[model samples]
Target: MLTLAETPPGAVVRVIEIMGGRGMRLRLMRMGLNLGDLVKVLSSGPLRGPVYLENLSTGVKLALGRGVASKVLVEPQ
Candidate 1:
């Protein structure tokens, strides 16, 4: 298991857990990122920038801040 922020670009992973408050979790869910969802890391920005991810099932892409990405736990798929 690894945090979303640690995943390399182009890596596919399944969301396991989100270690954040209700609002943060809800926000991610609204963006199609929920527990058990498969997503691909499109890009991880440099210098502590946002991370870009794409949902494999919905083809929805989202740009999340590094803080948020660090709270999302995932497993390699």
Candidate 2:
């Protein structure tokens, strides 16, 4: 498994796990980032601070902070 933030841009990843408590988990869920969902990395910088992701299920675009994105584990497909 690899972190979403560490994945290369344009790669499709399946959300495998989320590491956080109830509040944080719920917040991420509301943003359409749920387990088993597939997301594509849209863009990233050199250090991977902020990344743009597109939720395949909802077709929603979200910019996630590196710290939060790092907690999301995914498998490339």
Candidate 3:
């Protein structure tokens, strides 16, 4: 198991769960980041910034701030 936020760039992870409110949770869900979904870390931020991720299912990419990304639990493959 590994935190999605902690995963290095170019790595892939499977979403486990999201810990947050409905608003924030819904936002990520709408972005195709649902549980069991696979995502690839495109790039991490500078020092402590946001992280870029590419959705394996939808082929969409998104940049999530570190704080938010940290809340997203995942399993590294």
Candidate 4:
């Protein structure tokens, strides 16, 4: 499983797992990211900044901090 933080811009990946605690899981869920969702990496922010992505399932775009993104496990799709 590759973390979302490791994924490069322009890649499409499937959410495989979220390696975080329950609170983190709830936060991500409210942000519209969930297991099995397809997401496209839009911009991998610079200098350990946030990662911007688009949820292919809902056409929603959001930004996630590097730490939070690293907890999201994904597979290239």
lDDT of each: 0.94, 0.90, 0.88, 0.95
RMSD of each: 0.7, 1.1, 1.1, 0.6
Candidate 3 runs further than 4 Å off: none
Cand. 1 Cα-lDDT: 0.94
- Looking at candidate 2, what is the lDDT of residue 32? 80
List clashing residue pairs in candidate 2: none
Which lDDT value does model 2 have at 73? 95
> Residue 73 error for model 2, in Å?
0.3
Model 4: residue 56 alpha-carbon error in angstroms: 0.1
lDDT of each residue in 1-77, candidate 4, tens digit only: 79999999999999999998999999998999988999999999898999999999988899999999999999999
Off by over 4 Å in 4: none
Give lDDT tens digits, candidate 3, residues 1-77. Answer: 76777999999998988888899888998877788888999999888889999999789889899998989999887
Best by TM-score: 4
TM-score of each: 0.95, 0.93, 0.91, 0.97
lDDT at 43, model 1: 96
Instruction: Spell out the clash pairs found in candidate 1.
Output: none
lDDT comparison, 1 vs 4, better candidate: 4
**Over the stretch 8-42, how does candidate 2's per-residue lDDT look in tens digits?**
99999999999888887899999888999989999
TM-score of candidate 1 versus the correct structure, residues matched by position? 0.95
Clash pairs (backbone) in predicted model 3: none
